[model samples]
Target: MSIQYVGLKEIKGSLIILEGVTDVAFEEIVEITLEHGEKRVGRVIQITGDVAIVQIFEGTVGLSGSNTKTLFTGHPLEMPLSKEVLGRTFDGKGRPIDGLGEILAEKKIDINGSPLNPVTRKYPRNFIQTGISAIDGLTTLIRGQKLPVFSGNGLPHDQLAVQIVQQAKIAEGKGIENFAVVFAAMGVKNDVADYFRRSFEESGVIQKVAMFLNLANDPVAERIVTPRCALTTAEYLAFEHNMHVLVILTDMTSYCEALREISSSKGEIPSRKGFPGYTYSDLASLYERAGMLKDREGSITQIPILTMPNDDITHPIPDLTGYITEGQVVLSRELHQKGVYPPIIVLPSLSRLMKDGIGKGYTREDHPSVANQLFAAYAHVQEVKALASVIGEDELSDIDKKYMTFGHAFEKEFVSQGRNENRDIDGTLDLGWSLLGILPREELDRIAPELLDEYYKPYKKKGSDA
Candidate 1:
């Protein structure tokens, strides 16, 4: 017993107000039929007394208050799910755009997702190696963790992301299974969108990727739905099919801007930087969905990439994101200008969960110590460079000159790699040890004496022999 109401009380931007509506709920879907029988979709966003305010997904360019008919569908937005969703592309609204036709849905799931209880959450461990030395050897991305890449406008974050997709894999002997990637891009230009598709296809990882793209010209409402739809698909694959899923959400800054626009249209009170006060909770609703369930064999890892406005990390988007996610991979303009491919400033970038995930049985016995030494050595590099700027390099001590040499070689050999180069964890660790060989053994205070005797001494001996 559904009811259709002809005519409306008011039309405001993308919203239409209905008077005397009963039994309607918030977030419920609504159908808008125009005078000539053209149809549009909307959802109930706000309710007051017996009146409902609906925001149309498609804009209300041709609608009038009296000529349109509104009907409540009594259900929230949902996505059609099947394992076939992989290797396919869909619009932000969960409609297929790959010309592959609609999915034969095993089930239609609410895009809002099922609520996960905190008690059922399994602690994240075991790293997912991105194969980029800056990430793998330093800011390790742990499975079931939500780590973000904080980039800026002109950086090569897109290239870095594609490289990660092409090379990311679990450590050897962890499991025979390979994980699938769900890539969602919000408010990206058509050219950028095409690049993502073409890169994935050319790299041969497209078969395992599910892309949800909301182009720059698409409706703003779709930007809001894009990531939600992608996460829902990942949730189904991970929890039901028992597959490890890694979800990459790019340009979340656009999504937050879309939220701000919608909030302005609704006349809501604006909070910091014109963003709604509920931004934190709203983000939590999405980020908190990532993790492994205690009873499930699979996991969901999230790498949410957002560009800070004007490279300002304090902007509301990245600021709030830093508060929510585990840790951030901060891209460096300095390094990018210096010809570093990944451009990740390892000092500022870290994975808080790396301690539990790497070392011993997970990656390698020397991983933790090597990573710590890299950080310490890099930090000293910056200091020595600053000192050399004031007093000439000739005036610096021998140890300081050694640090400068180590720093240059570290960036050129370790951080910079070919785009297609895929290094295993062992290769990454060996390269790290080789770089440590440039510094004297006494400076490697982070490593145990035994580990230095094992990994560092061999590298120092090889350097001496050469």
Candidate 2:
């Protein structure tokens, strides 16, 4: 039999203090009944001796200290799992919101997730093609890797995320039967949520996506649970059903802000920028959940997108994220001003796991050489532009002038693409070769002699006054 207690200890922000509670486990879900028997849900966030503090998921409103009845469920929050989760939409707490009714659960798993042993982990290999030249050719996203997109306010990160969802696939013409996506949006506006849903449905990719949405006006407590619920679903699909799952988490900064708010309400001592000191571990708990098990056939790849606070990458949230994830795709405000859609700052963005994923049997033999050469040529383009600003473009040497033309075409034709345009790997690679043709043959130093002979077709430099 369960014990019921009349709550009257205190009412704080999103938390309600319950006195004389026994045998209550931490993180256990609670059932709160008002005097008139309106049901509300909560979770045990803190336990000090016999006093327990519960965070209400539906916000703490309309409850009196004298008339409230609380019951501890003695179990942590669990998400119902099945193959039916795909194409479904759920609230932050894993409750169905799409009017599809409840999931006939095959089994229920804890949202906190089962701890994965580091020794049993498998090294990531191969790449997930996003069909965008900038991502596929440069910062390649390997299967089972955790790569983040570092964006800022008012950038086009949302559009980029949508594009990836629509176009991402396992390499080498692998069918969609084995791939799926899980998207979580925390603290987004209702219109933005509607846009995400509409865009996916219109693109016909919604059937493979499961979305967890926590709106901006929702309780802050729900924001904290959003990503965990999304990952829990991904794990179920990947490990149980042997599906390669790609999980996209957007606006993680909002989740951290919710943590800070909860910490402030708990009266805990503040750390950097008034956030809890455990911020790093908290983020790691989410990111580390992605990977392939040594013996498992499936994998989970994560692309967590967070907007930098005040466009400052040095802020504590991004600074700590840099330490946890493999590498980042940093967006450029300068490129945005120049009418670039994705606005990816190529020089600063990279995937640490990319080298192992591309080349030979994976993407192409020339992928590594082409990417390295592009990085070198773009770096030189910056130098020539700086010199041009100082001494004007007309005074530059012939080779510098060639670089000027290459840079212009590179950004216009390569970095920028239509919102709906999707290119295959061969199309992207062939485009890279064509762009390299703008430079002289001697300038292509990164490729092997045989590859240069086979792929390089140098464009003749234009004569002065011609």
Candidate 3:
């Protein structure tokens, strides 16, 4: 029989200290029954000597003194797993809230999954097309890579996330039929969650998506389990079911905040910005779960989104995240103000594994050169604009004026696309060449002379419009 103890040596916030406890394992689930017969769920977070510190998932609101009964289940928290989980919606704790009823689990697995051995991990090489020119043509998202989207508050990162879910696909002709998405949102508003559901349903992709949502008003403690539960489902689908799964965790800043709150309640020593010292390791445990096995047919890729506080990239949340993920796609407030749809800064944005995913066989033969040339030309555009600002535009040389025209066309044509528009790789590359046509031939140093001869079209100077 499982042991039940009369607890409550102390109650602090959502945590309770129980004395004289035996055989209580760390992270073991505990059932707390109050004097009035109201029950709450908690987990053993820490154990020292004979005392255990339990964190209540439902919070300790009504409990008083040692009268409450604490039952130690002697097992960690687990979630039911099955292919039927897709198209279903669940709350933070993995309980179905979609009104579709309980899942007939194929098997149960611990939410804290085992890390894949490095020796058995295959390098991520294939590209996943997002259908956005800024991404597919520039910073390509590689299968099994962890790339994050860095944004500021009130930016359209949420919309971008939805678009990616609707448009992301494996390269054409790969003939891989099994693909899915595990989307987990932490501390989002009810309206935001509803938007995702409605969008997925309307787009007809909901059947292939498994959603885990923790609202802004849900118990903060539940936030800790949200991503873990979502990732566990992804691991099940990818490694066992042989499916390519994409896991999207939005607003990870909230997850970090929850960890800090729990740490403070436990009176633990704080690290940077009052976050726990183990924040990096805690995030690693979640992100490292994505990749392909040496001999497996499936893979898991992650796109973790976080809004930098006050637009500060140096904030601990984004600073730490940048260190862990492969690279970042940074959203720009300046570009948004200028009416860019995706508002990608492009300059600061990059994909570290992009080299492996693009080139001869993966994307297109001309992808590398096109991307490099666009980057070089855009970078020069910035310098030319700076010079034009100091010395009036009328004082600039003819070549600088041509660069000015190229800059305008690049933003209006290359970066800006209709919100609903989904461009294929060929179309995006074609548009890149069109924009490069506006610049003089001599300025195209990044492109091979052979490619320039084949693709470059000189833009006729003004007054030739007639």
Best by lDDT: 2
Q: Rate the local accuracy (lDDT) of all candidates.
A: 0.90, 0.92, 0.90
**Candidates, ranked, TM-score:** 1, 2, 3
The alpha-carbon lDDT assigned to residue 212 of candidate 1 equals 93
What is residue 134's positional error in candidate 2, in angstroms?
0.8
TM-score of the candidate numbered 3?
A: 0.96
Model 2: residue 112 alpha-carbon error in angstroms: 0.3
Question: 275-373 in candidate 1: lDDT tens per residue?
Answer: 999999988888888999999988899999999999998999999999999999999899899988888888889899999899999899999999999
In candidate 3, how many Å is residue 411 off?
Answer: 1.7
Clashing pairs in 1: none
TM-score of every candidate relative to the true structure:
0.97, 0.97, 0.96
User: Which 10-residue span in candidate 1 carries the lowest summed lDDT?
Assistant: 457-466
Estimate, for each residue in 273-311, the C-alpha lDDT of model 3 and write its tens digit.
Answer: 999999999999898998999888889999999999899
- Please give the lDDT score at residue 350 for candidate 2: 89
Q: Tell me the tens digit of each residue's lDDT in model 2 across 1-466.
A: 7898986699889999988889999999999998988999999999999999999999889998998999888899999999999999999999999999999999999999999989999999999989888888989999999999999999999899999999999875553688999999999999989989999999999999999999999999999999999999999999998899999999999999999999888889999999999999999999999999988888999999999988898999889999999989999999999998779889988899999999999889999999999989999999999999999999999999999999987888888889888987778887888889999889989989999988887653335232
